[model samples]
Target: MSTLDTSALVIGVDFGTDSCRSLIVDTITGEQVASAVEFYPRWKAGMYCDPDRNVFRQHPQDYIDAFTLAVRNALAGVSDEVRANVRAMSIDTTGSTSVAVDRAGTPLALTEPFRDNPNAMFVLWKDHTAVREADEINTLARNWGGVDFTRYVGGVYSAEWFWANMLHVLRVDPAVRASVYSWVEHCDWMPALLTGTTAPDVMKRSRCAAGHKAMWHESFDGLPGEAFLVRLDPLLAGMRERLYRDTYTADTAAGTLTPQWADTLGLTTDVVVGVGAFDAHMGAVGAGIRPYSLVKVMGTSTCDILMAPAAEVDGRIVKGICGQVEGSVISGMTGMEAGQSAFGDVYAWFRQLLAWPLALLGDTPDAQSQRDGILHRILPELERQAALESPVDTGMVAIDWLNGRRTPFADQTLRGALFGLTLGSDAPKIYRALIEATAFGARAIVERFREEGIRIDEVIAVGGVAKKSPLNMQIVANVFGLDIRVAKSDQAVALGAAMFAAVAAGLHDSVESAQRHMGSGFETTYTPDPEATAIYDRLYRQYREYGALIERLSAAEAHPAPHSTELCTPN
Candidate 1:
């Protein structure tokens, strides 16, 4: 019905930890024509989490609601002709983020205590409750330096990743675990739902998720080995076998949408679904990363880095570094991922504590409208005022492991800490300290990567933090002593997913070709200032010391019987 040839549109959906977004992008120019974002309020504003401290898990239905809402809104703004021309739909979501489903393919965790229950829901990518099992994996893999899969990950694994949650489920709920008939990544399953398929043959599983999270391979039969999984947990032995399936790259056509899904969505069911992937990795592709280029997904939490390299580091994995198979990001080259444990979540925590009445600030709001009167708005203004107040006024620094370190060390039990606090400390000082801490966390990961011969040439920053906070971006540049590549598009993840769809539909021959042809926008780079860098270097040492002290305290709490006060660093 539509006659546009080069201007064909594609719907790319991003399934985030708290919400889902849909975007309509011009296939040839890669320009986003229209967009819609839907937030799960129960999932948002931190409402549905456990009373105790752990990350939030989402119901797959939440993503479904978001998918339908975002799709309708995206179409609502387009002309009927434009809608009809859309050739395909693709999706990206947080990696290894999954759910248990009944025979009918409905998410079982959505309705009950499972949403807040530690064991019942999808163990989110940032969740840390499974650290004990993760540590064992680390210990078991120590002899090999890390798993062969570590090549895709950064020669290190964390409890927050897919394997950690899978093992955790097996250990804690052994009985209920067997009742779990199926386990599918939210991004992988989303398209299957649209097309009516199962894990085995229904839709293509992303090589990014399959390689990075599920331990699938470009070269192997499937998974690492049943023996290794049995060592981690006996149940994981069976779990790995069940989840093992043929993996597909980002550009592969997963399946066509089913007639039922087409009727419900009010578009042709022939829409293509590319194999889905982790939001951040796809964010890199959407940003048009060249070989060995790094894309950092910045948000409440940060998935710091992913890249495609030119050559295989022959001894890279052998040097006790973590790596995954070749062509993890794209088909021709390998992709690697790493990140800071906390970013926006730290700021959200501070806002909750500081956003009180004027009496709370001990200063009156003079003549200001209530619209600009709240601490939420006032805090940014104060941070600006204080940054200019004195170079040392934003003097406090902290380590951002508030939710524990997701990488470099991979310790989840390690908590947050604020150093250099004084009687003069207030909301602004503490907030800036938190910002500096996350910047340092990024630097640590960057430093570690470069230390092991992995070159991170450009830091591509995307997500809520990078888009909204200039101060945070400035600090990040200063801390890393490197310029950052910022996405011109706000919805990098959604755009990335759509790029996959374009590849799947044969609009482009491969993801790499699609990235060049259809990926949107130029990058904005922030170079680090030398003066700021010098000051941060000294402050970073103290920040490390402060983090080490707290980690010792946490270690003591966990193993109180024979622990000393010495700080422990990773091997």
Candidate 2:
């Protein structure tokens, strides 16, 4: 360990769905010094995406460009003292956002031949184009006469994960497959890139991403066996050897920054870069997560993280979560993940649906400005108006599967549905229904943990929706019948990364120690309203009943019985 520098600052860069943000914080006080954000130009322009097909890809140059500008801009607002004294940095990214790479660990999208190819770019975590591959993986895991790799990942593999996305790309694009040497998660790649250790064999992979999304468990001796891969697909025959066998937690240092990166980010080569992890895992740490507490990272989607003592959860596998990986959150605790695939996204979709008229008033500058103003105000206005509506009087129930369900079962094929809507149902009423639907979805996750014997003593909320929407938070609290605390830091995910950086740089002995010295406490607590809770409880039962019916109908439609004239006949 190195000497502690109480004055030292650390940088935490969070690569999110739409943009990248950099936060600089004091190592000892945890005071946020400066911050900057840069939206990915390409992504913001809606390049390389087809929402109808659930295909989303981001160019690696977008990450490189965005983070570089964000960090430099963040540093520009601070003194040279802050810049020179920065001792370390760490990163968190949307997980299962991976891309094919060459032997040198250069993303294929960065190479000249594949520079413009969407297939060679980084697959965003929310992309669900790999549903078929995920189903195949799940089926093989269950029936294969060997180790069940997905057993630790809640007995289900999701289309949003590493293997499914990789397999999907390989099967669809021969050019990417031919040039690819291995695949690397976005979280793993950033640190490796900064530390100048981008070689496929040398880069340190994230235990959080690998364990949760890629099924890399110590008991499995790393990834699943070569036999399993070969059985799953001939294309994956030798992939196990190409991919990693070992993983490191975020508390460890990946390496020191290289001179080029140091110059690029206005830092010195002495600054250490810690191993990266998924945004939600690190966000939990930033939110002051403790054992038996659930931290919800609410943004475009919601990723719920809960850490427990390893000994208590040793042989227990919670059936339908993202995964349970040891040391993924706290250094010595077991981290379990669960989430709704759509939370804020559902609201965004509804807003878009309402704003369709804006598309017609286009091209003119005045029209454009008016359109932008309306778009900006739509959500806030909806939240306010919806808050005024009576929850029980709406008599509308909605299923929050607009982007598919992510927890209590990882099913992506299911679509969002609304019921009991009449002509009298207005925008505010429908919007209120959507909010309740998301809340109900969250309650389902909390109930799943309880059913599995995992005790959740408290709930913490962090992210855009949590901070901006009191109505959403209150509804969630009522739905769960539990109080919810909002984390104080607006940049909790980035702050969590800084905590890891502090430990990796030896400014702190462990993550817990760093957190105690630097944590931003809760800003507000939302308590369940008794009357609202009672109404929500009744609506929640209906939500579950409706969700089950939707799931059954979806499954039956996907794989109907051979001679099924049953649909034509009444029961």
* Model 1 per-residue lDDT tens digits across residues 1-571: 1223485789889888778899999877777899999997657656546626575676565677778888998899989889888999888888667666544554556546454554556667777777777777766765644355444455466777677777777667754475565567777778777877764434566677776666566445666667777776677656655565577777777778888778777789778877777787788787777765667788878875445453665446422222444655677676766666678888877775665454444434552444245745765775675465333676677778877786675677888877667888876677777778888888877777777777766778888788877788888899888888788888888888888888788777677667766666655678889998998898888888887778777766766654555544432
Please give, for residues 55-136, the per-residue lDDT of candidate 2 as tens digits: 9999999999999999999999998877899999999999889999999999999999999899899999999999999999
lDDT of 1 at 210: 72
Error of 1 at 240 (Å): 2.6
Which residue pairs in candidate 2 have backbone atoms (N, alpha carbon, C) closer than 3 angstroms, thus clashing?
Answer: none
Worst 10 residues of 1 by lDDT: 314-323
Question: What do the candidate models score in CA lDDT, each in turn?
Answer: 0.72, 0.93
lDDT score of model 1?
A: 0.72
Against the true structure, what is every candidate's RMSD? 4.3, 1.6
